[model samples]
Target: MSQTIVALDCMGGDNAPGEIIKGGIEALKENKDVFLKMVGRQEDVNRELEKYDYDKTRVEVVNATEVIETGEPPVVAIRTKKDSSLVKCMYMVKHGECDALVSAGSTGATLVGGHVIVGRIKGVERPPLAPLIPTEKGGALLIDCGANVDAKPSNLVQFAQMGSIYMENICKVKNPKVGLVNIGAEEEKGNNLAKETYQLLSNLEGINFIGNIEAREIPEGKADVVVCDAFVGNVILKMYEGVGGVLLKKVKGTLMTSLKTKIGALLIKKELKETMKTFQMDQYGGAPLLGLKGLVVKTHGNSKAIEVKNSIIQCISFKEMNINDKISKKLAVKKEN
Candidate 1:
């Protein structure tokens, strides 16, 4: 089996070098075919490495003197923070030194670095951040969740196309149904952007465009690939997270309010827990900025070790499945046809 090397941004997330290093070590221990290049301050990385026991050859430490904080301007940070761990990791992917990069850092920085450093694939108008969102029917890929806030009609058509490829290849959803996010099911009931995108997606070949889907249908899994501009997509994503959290809290509170309900909760605790686990963002890892030359995943800024580890493993699968090549071929075929 070919080895998949992933560059880890050690100082990017809320947990910093400690959780990042731990996750990298855990991924290395679990997958023998994976290698890691930990990038951060020398002393910090070395200190973390000493706590773990793994094959020394499978891991390499690279020194990066600067750390880009979440508050820094994304474009400026990427250009100015030459010695930052995130920038160095981006360069590694750009130069083919690493197969992918996983970060729990500033989302803006990750997105900007992906476009500026790694560059987009040929003929790709814009690369959107597509994340697998948990739904009733397993999951769906939400493209442009936060990448391009002001997307054009053509951009959304590409989002549907790229999202379909991702779902089919990575999530194993064949002939994934694509839906345009809109206010109503009727084709004429949206803003100019939605109406234009709906027409384009409906006419586009090689995608399973399923007409308009409202926000309410998203949780019900009305579409396997939900296509929308970043503005709408971001709103939907935030709503999902917020609603999920509130519902979970409400359930827990209601169960604990009465001894009878508490007993009932205990009886179904295992099953309930398992069902809830299916909806967690960590299980699906991070969102990938699709169309980049190399994979760039942005996990939650407050991500813990499990999210980090899963993101690393996610990178391995992306490379192994040859997602980028598949996307390139798909787009090329579209042009030819």
Candidate 2:
């Protein structure tokens, strides 16, 4: 099998070269067919790389002189910070030097660089950031999580199509059910955007459109692909994360409150731990900006080694599945009809 070459922005995330490099090393250890071109300051990257005993042949360092801080304007940073790690890493994918690019960097910069550098798949109206959220039935893909805040009805339809393709091909969900995020389950519940989008999606070919999905029903895994405009999608994604964190902390606190509860906790600890693992966001890795010519995955900025490793590993499946080619073909067929 041909190796999957990935360019990683080692200096972009909060833990930076340290946690990022560790994650790369872990990915290499797990997947022999994956190779990494770690892009960052050569010396700083090497210092982190030296800490791990990894296959030297599978990993190489590409020096990037500058770093794009999260606060800087994305458009201006991409245009001016030519030597920044994020820009350099993105260019690697654009030039075909790498099959994919992974970054925990500035979301704005990643989004801008993905469009400007990696470019979008031909015939794709808009590329959406789609992330997998844990659900009762396993997981669901949340599309347009933060890419296009004000999207057109056509864009939402495209998001549903692209998201379905992703879940089926990469996540191995067959004929994945697609749902539109709305205030109620009824078809006529939402505003003009939702109503118009529902009509378009319902008429779209090749996807299993499952009407509207209320936010309350998301945890029950009512649909495999949840489609919405970026503003709504981002709100759901953030709230999902925040609520999960607080609930877990509260559960732990409650369990430790008294001796009787502590004893009960010990009895259920193993089972509880296994059940909780199902809801962890990091287990699924970062969200991919679907409809791009080359793969671009954006992890959380505060990601640790586990999330980093999972993000890199996530690229292997995307490359192996030839997701871009499939998306291009699907969109081209839609255009022809």
Candidate 3:
């Protein structure tokens, strides 16, 4: 088996070097064909590495002197922080030193660095952040979660195309159904942008367009690929996460209300826990910024070891499937016709 090399930003997330290093070690244990280049302060990375027992040959520490904070402006930070872990990680993928780059740092910085450093695939108008959200049918790809806030109709068409490719190739959703986010299922039911996008997507070839889908039907898995501008998509994504967290807390509270309820909770604890795990966003890993020349995945800034580990492992499939090349070919063929 060929080895997949992933460059991870060790000092990017809320947990910083410790959790990131732990996740890398855990990923190494799970997949022997994976090699990781930890990018951050050499001393901090080495200090974390000493806490684990593993084959040191599979892991390399790349020194980065600075760290980009969440508060810093993305474009300014990426331009100014030449020695930052995030910038170095982006360069690693840009220069082909690694197959992919995974970071839990500033989302803005990651997105900006990805476009500025790694560049976008030829013929791709705008690269959108596509993330898999757990749904009734399995998982749905929410495109443009937070990339381009004000998108054009043509951009939506491209997002649908790239999103469809991702679902079919990466998520293994056969002939994935695509839907436009709107006020209603009717074709003429949205703002000027939505109406224009609906027409474009409906006439577009290759994608399985299913018309407009209401926000309420999203959780029921109305479509495998939900297309919308970043403003709307980001709102939906945040609401989903916020609601899921609150619901889980309420369930726990209810289970501990009284002695009888507590007993019932104990009886169904295993099954309930298993069911909850399916809805966890962390289990699905980070969102990939599609249409880029290389893979760039951004996890939550507050991500833990498990989320970090899964994010790194997710790159293995992305590399093996060659998603970036697939997107390039798809768009190139479309442009030719």
RMSD of each: 1.6, 1.3, 1.3
Candidate 1 lDDT by residue in tens digits, 235-278? 88899889889999999999998889999999999999999999
- In model 1, the Cα lDDT at residue 1 comes to 89
Give a tens-digit lDDT track for model 2, residues 182-242: 9998888999999999989888889999999999988899999999999999999889889
User: TM-score of each candidate?
Assistant: 0.95, 0.97, 0.96
Flag regions of model 1 displaced more than 4 Å: 263-265
Query: What does candidate 2 score on TM?
Result: 0.97
lDDT of 2: 0.92
Model 2 Cα displacement at 289 (Å)? 0.6
> Local distance difference test, per candidate?
0.91, 0.92, 0.92
Task: Give a tens-digit lDDT track for model 3, residues 199-274.
Answer: 8888888999999999988889999999999999999999988998899899999999999999999999999999
* Worst ten in a row by lDDT for model 3: 276-285
